[model samples]
Target: MTDDLLLTGARVLDPGGGRSGRYDVAVRGGRIAAVGADLPHRDARHVVDLRGKLLTPGLVDLHTHVYAGATYWGIHPDPVAWYSGVTTWVDAGSAGAYSIEAFRRAIRDFRVRVPVLLNISAVGLTGRTGESRDLENCDVDLAVATVADNRDLVAGIKVRVDRETVGRHGTEPLRRGVEVAAACGLPVMVHIGTTPPRLADVLALLRPGDIVTHCASAIAAAADGGGPVSPALREAHAAGVLLDIGHGSGGFAFDVLEAQLAAGLTPYSVSSDLHARCLYGPAFDLPTTMAKLLAVGLTLDEVVAAATVRPARALRLPDGIGTLTPGAPADLAVFTVEDGPFELVDAHRQRRYAPRRLVNDATYVAGRLLPPRLPEPPRPWIPLTAAQRQALQRRAGTVRALLTAPLVGPEGLAEQFPRQQAAVPLDPAAAVREPVADPVSEEG
Candidate 1:
């Protein structure tokens, strides 16, 4: 009969619905009850003052690898999701038919939403590359059956079409991936990388509504590196192929993206492609990747749509996953939209400045606020710079000290017992402690 939660006095932004204003959002039973100035109840079980904050639909990252512990690229989303405001993480090509069951089991414990793009190769992205090199693993029938059985989980198909992944096999893996998607009546997402099969051949196999991740990849678009956009890319953009900025460690380039924008080709979705390696620096999280788009001249509305509704449209996600419309999933993100000449970096290490930025303050999934989660240390195979290694060590040390030290001194404690000798200890020796230099916090 009453709302479960009421968030009042904030700038509500629903790019998918093209609605933006200072409005109150109500949540009930883990779904958005209403989004307007007035509600049925004057109060709720819990009310939060969201004054001066920007509230929007929880971000939907279209490309990520959250199949942790089993694959090389996988990284759990919760560690970053809570702080980054991403509720939906699309695990693109992280698992395939052979590993789909295992992948399902692995993700069962994740706190955030994980929609999958079944890899064409049965082995999936278990290693760095070459998942599709063995054509036997690229079985279309198996992939189709896998999708059919798990229709709700499998968003579409994903194939990494590159020289290293396909080896001498060329475009066969991509063709097979397309076949599986076609049979299942789903769009296929193709990852473009190093040459040998040529970007043109890869693009030729794709149909409209299909996604081309890493569209501005430096390696994949190397031929048009500093120059204008290529004819093949131009034609694909004209033909309705959706472009996604899969900003992985080596997949994004400021120059390339800039060129694309100049040529009137804006990315349909902005994704971090967050994996184990890039999670620390380049593609830190979806918000950071979205910031890169902001730096590259996209307005806040456009960037929000790219990170939310547009990606949802690309995947055809259900349950109003990307909007704050009434009756939609009560997934929300609140941000402190800060004034900035903020410096943001791309995968190529190039920098740009933006006039304003959205820094997350809180993330909510299903109307429940997400608690903080510490990220696991990088895998032994993950390469880190000297500075990064030292930073990790310092962070660990700080956390250790913070948790290991006594929470309160005797002076701050109260007597818990009323028995004789329940008096607090005030001995000068026990109360007096050696002076230690305060450790200057290194975190910003």
Candidate 2:
């Protein structure tokens, strides 16, 4: 242990301390051997002076995808995690019983620290539209068997119970999902949105330690046409169920988040839900996602807790990750807080307020900074003719239609149609867009 690495002059933020201090940390054999001032540097093999940087426990993104080509919907976890200051990332149901082994062979066995959440469905989100709905693929015995086989790597059970996937048998799938998870003595992570048997009924079935993701989603309108996070959410939280914010392409809702936050019901943890579909904007990576929550009243410590300790606990890897305790794995992140007018987006293709920029300066796993990855290539800024630009502007009036276009769905579209003009004031506002009679009605 004499030939160790020394990282000095860092503003270390220890969650356990609930305070930060300037200190040095020593790493030997992939474990943090010490943290103090004047650590012996004579026998050190490497010394990195991280001055003017904030050092914290490596980010732990509890919700992500890593199956690569297997799950066409997601990017490789190692590239996404390491490049964005996340050392540990849980693959949230990109594979299941049938494909879990292959996933391990291709992903988990690698040097990267990526864990998996076995999907309740065997194939695990196979085809985008309705593959998760096939009851045959969601065999309970099979899922349990898979978990038992890979208990060391399988954190919990994941099931998407949205309207498009679960249809009328929403509760049934969730019940079976719980049963399967119970067989392995593991918790179930249920994705709640848009289906039958309301949010309350579904949440009522969850127990302590079980996870409810997408809790703050604008799906499954209430009797009053509101989002989930209903009275049942309060009941479930009181009972110790964890509310995980899986802010995916279609799950994050500003109104729901604000309502819940105002009601003193913040998410227990925040997850990237990093998939190919939504990675373009709003949900680029985990740090950006965390910054979004940090914008809306959460302290830096509180936001860090959501990405670290809370998520680690939810994954049942509390000891292995989410902290910088002595002898713990040397997973760490360095970040810089930049000022002013930072933009954050939600899953609803909506923008929100952010005052500080949470930029990932660097990331390390077991004391080794993974190779830097290049930033994504900027989109081609097509120089449209004046006529074309005018046409695009005209098309902007039909926002609903433009939103349906494949390219316009992501944040990139906003660049094409900048909000330059303010609408004129109206007496009551309802008279601004008066409804015109149909051609047939007018003729009559």
Cα-based lDDT at residue 354, candidate 1: 78
Quality of model 1 by C-alpha lDDT: 0.89
Q: Report residue 161 deviation for candidate 1 (angstroms).
A: 0.6
CA lDDT, every prediction? 0.89, 0.76
lDDT of 2 by residue, 178-245 (tens): 89877777888888766565777788778899998877777643431444446677898989898878
Cα TM-score of candidate 1? 0.91
Candidate 1 lDDT over residue span 148-207, tens digit each: 999989999999988889999989999999999999989999998887798888888889
**Cα RMSD for candidates in order:** 10.6, 21.2
The TM-score obtained by model 2 is 0.81
Please report, as a residue range, the 10-residue window in candidate 1 with the lowest summed lDDT. Answer: 221-230
Clashing pairs in 1: none
Per-model TM-score on C-alpha atoms: 0.91, 0.81
